[model samples]
Target: MSMFLITCSSSFAQKNELKELEKLVKRNNTTETAALLSTVEKMLPQATDDQKAAYYFFKTKNLINLANSGVDFNENRSKAIESINHLIKFENETKSKKYTTEVTALKNTLLAELVDEAIDSNRNKDYKKSSRLFEQAYNLNATDTVYLYYAASDAVNAKDFDYAESKFKDLIKLKYNGESQTYVATSQTTGKVESFGFDRKARDLAVKSGTHTKAETIFSKSAKPDIYNNLTHILLNKQNYSEAENYALTAYNLDKDNVNSLLNVLFLYYNTNRLDRFEEHAKKGIERFPQNEILLYNLAIINMQNNQNEQAKEYLSKILLLNKNHFDALKSLGNIELQKDADITNKINALPNTTTSNKKRNDLMQEKRLVYTTTLDYYKKAQAINPKDESLNELITQIQDFLKNN
Candidate 1:
């Protein structure tokens, strides 16, 4: 009976000590709370689970205050998360209803700090660190889907492809939905890139109101199209062409006007030797961006591959009109002329020996000479555009020899 009384007395004393700690928490006594946490932790084995939960609860609160005071924030943040999680689990299982309101408020405060830190880190391009903070915040507060999305996006920015892919797939599984995004656009009238007129005022109002009210934004969650495109880019980088093409097509189907998706599909089709599909996209790209020099140049190559010399010449001429010093287009034009000149040489060779001096033979030779001259002229212009190509120098050497003999 004496031993039983002693055990009861010890338990009662421990509860009183926890009550004192609770008073310190209520009074916001950071220094005293911090000093007592270590002593409470040492009693964990002897303490009841309720006492243990209270101990962790105070420890978490104390450390969070310390974090706000500019102490080792990362260390304190990590410990606070660990202790709070345990505290909540114990409180819930025991149905103690202990510190529930304060706990909820405390958790939200931690989450806000974590989100702020994540944004700062991402702004500084420390994507790896940003991803970690956001993922931590997401785990702490499961309801805020935004944190999870930021974690995945920053993972992609960091090039942690495996993690990003997993999170993106999870996003799909969740059927995550998002609102429309306003974006800065070039004014067709002014020909100047700028945000819409109301964006600044709207953004300021949102900031003042602490809400995501209507304002210009990018990378908003309606993410299926972007997610597929990003997956396609990852697969393409890994040379997984089959999967890349599938994902690229999915992205295109999601948003037809997405130029980036179109470009990815075009590249995938061309690389995978789907010439018909490649031709289709190339033509579409030209229709969409008629003034885009690279697209125009690519269309020329498509025509050249199909042996439509006249069409190829027309495309190349359009490029020259846009930028006369387009070296590759000029070189390709020279190549087509050389190919025609080769046919003339073959016709001359097919003639009988006696026909060499005839008017017909002379006329054919004259046309062949003019073709050679044109090839040399175009090639020389291309060489002038970029003087470093040794292949061009070699071609010039051959052209000079042909001109001297002819």
Candidate 2:
């Protein structure tokens, strides 16, 4: 196949050629603008400062216009950024100030456009697309760390765990305290939506104008705690317990009251058999969240693990007081009472051979019967909560049989 190249036939020595490029750029004709810019770049070494400035600026302008027009998606975004850099370089080299305001505003406008699109994509539940868009926006402007946070959050929503982990790690490395402005369109408001960068005067004017109201700055809370907790969750899901625990500890240190992080710490310690650590935080969690049923249940479990049945029973009892239908607590209390039956049976077995002490054996058997009866009552409560549970039903039947035989 033969290829045809369309170059600006008019020489750069002619002003007509520059005007033609400008016309093509304004018309959003990327194909022809790029073709002419390619030819102009070859002449840059000998071109006048003004000619060179015009060339680079219009190149950026053309690409940006194409991006705005949606003629090309990813390609134009990168190309526009690249060309804008070249234009900025030319301005600095020539000590010229032309197009400075336009370049700065357009660059910001491009990033804002990307952010808006990402929000739209996320609103529509296209999390994967939202992640990619926010990622592109962040890459285009790394200073906007909140966009990176949004990208990571979207990746999590998409279940792209590894990618989300990497993005979150980057935020951690930056010590990014995620901050962003939350604009609420109140019933009473003022100012143009695009009018950002509010100072005292601007804010006052905005309020007076009655179309814009700046919501409170979201600076009090750092994004790092959330970031660390998110990392912990991802690590836990991947079964990387050590790393998960480390991240959870970091989050806990950052904010001791972070429930997810604190709970993760408890879970990591408990599941890894670090009962001491589990009990320590579990108690602290209970101190903070007195009415938290899950923490109470877990505390009871930790006590049970250490054979502190009385303490375990106390914790479970509190849960029952708060929520009578707490099935887990009911089941756990039933199981603990069953353990009492086992203890009494052990006592009866250890009694000297019945021939040597029939009376002691009889007393032990009487005590065992009483314990079994209590076990039946506890299990019956559990049965009321879940009658179909096979284990509970079987235990109840065994207790009934023992009572009958005794």
Candidate 3:
């Protein structure tokens, strides 16, 4: 009877249920596939926990198959998530090598699918959804610096800067000395083009190690301009203006034309109230880009602060010639004219008995009228360029009224 039963079981009609499931899944007959998977799940209680966990993994594979078939993917994803969680739980409870390995493989596969989904979401500009998927991928494999870096980038685009910073910190923390060089190379090759990956690593390590003094010594030995720029920014943020200035000067010496370092030096001077140094650097910036409207404007502001009205006017006139709609320069010119009018009014008041000066006052008034008319024309042109500036419109109205009344 035993021999006869073995022979009957060997026939194709009594084949293994799991093998039958494979055939059904291959045929894309989801209904039959689901039914077979459920039957296998039912057989788990009588089998070892490893067998039960293996059945759950098969269920996860079926879920992935459904996900790939373009049929109710959300439901398929949920099913896969549930099965993988159960597999993880069982493997942990039983400490079974077979179950653990299978679960790990399934987790990795799921994570890869999630990463692909994130790429699709990003392509569609669904950044929030993409970030969620990237977070899922990171949770599955925290050691994957590539995934972590991408997640951090997505967070940054979403304006979650704090979270992005934290993610970057996590990646940097993963670097052991032996692996640091490799990590730096991989970060450069695979990370965002604009990101400072290894420098970020070194910075975080320096902070955590509380050996920034040592790190600074080592960094100074190399004297990289980029490193100096980063350190300068940090020092500036900490309100260490002197140290910041030193770093900025060091970087400027390395690359004289570096805009960031130059700006940093100017900022240091401005914050430290070193007006002389500010003026010096402002002159240097102007000399470097003689035609730059911004540099010219900055020079005019410095002159204005020094009570050098004629010099300020000269720079302001140059700016207005280059950019006629320079609102700041126009306003400054108006203020200067008002100051001149105040001084002339004081002189006229002091000479009350000089009736012969009436002719001179009349000529001066005509000159003021011509200047006001020219200013009104400039304001009109500025209004045309920037219609959204209500202040400009108001100034135009005031000038028109003043011209009519005077």
Q: Identify the leading candidate in terms of TM-score.
A: 2
Q: If scored against the real structure, what TM-score would every candidate get?
A: 0.58, 0.65, 0.46
Candidate 1 per-residue lDDT over residues 310-394, each given as its tens digit: 9999999999999999999999999989888777778878888884457778988899888889999999999999889999889
2 or 3, greater by lDDT: 2
In model 3, which residue pairs have backbone atoms overlapping below 3 Å?
A: none
Model 1 CA RMSD to the hidden true structure, in angstroms: 8.3
Model 1 regions lying over 4 Å from their true place: 1-10, 16-52, 62-76, 82-96, 180-221, 280-406
Lowest summed lDDT over 10 consecutive residues: which window, candidate 2? 1-10
Which stretches of model 2 miss by more than 4 angstroms?
1-18, 45-53, 65-72, 85-94, 179-199, 206-219, 241-246, 271-273, 294-320, 323-406
> How many angstroms is residue 139 displaced in model 1 relative to the true structure, after the best TM-score fit?
3.0
**lDDT tens digits by residue: candidate 3, 1-406:** 9987755654423237766776776677777888887777656545666556656766777887898787898678767777777778777788875657766887878887899999999899777667767866766665554566567667656766556546545554653111232112222233432322447676556446643322222221222455466557667877878757776897788777666677778778877889889879877886776667766776677667778889899988999889888877777776565556566556556665577988877777776667677777666665666778887778778778978998
lDDT (10s digit) by residue, model 2, range 1-406: 1222212333434356678898998888888988888877877766667777888788888878787778776788878877776777778887987777888787788888889999999999999899988988877777777889999999999999999999999998888986545433333533434333424465556567875565333234778889999899898888899788778899999988777778889878877889788878877898898888887887788789889999999999999999998888888887887676677677777777758688888877888787778777778887888899998899889889978887
* Span of ten consecutive residues with least summed lDDT in model 3: 176-185
RMSD of each: 8.3, 7.5, 13.0
Candidate 3 differs from the real structure by a C-alpha RMSD in angstroms, to one decimal, of 13.0
**Global CA lDDT of candidate 1, please?**
0.80
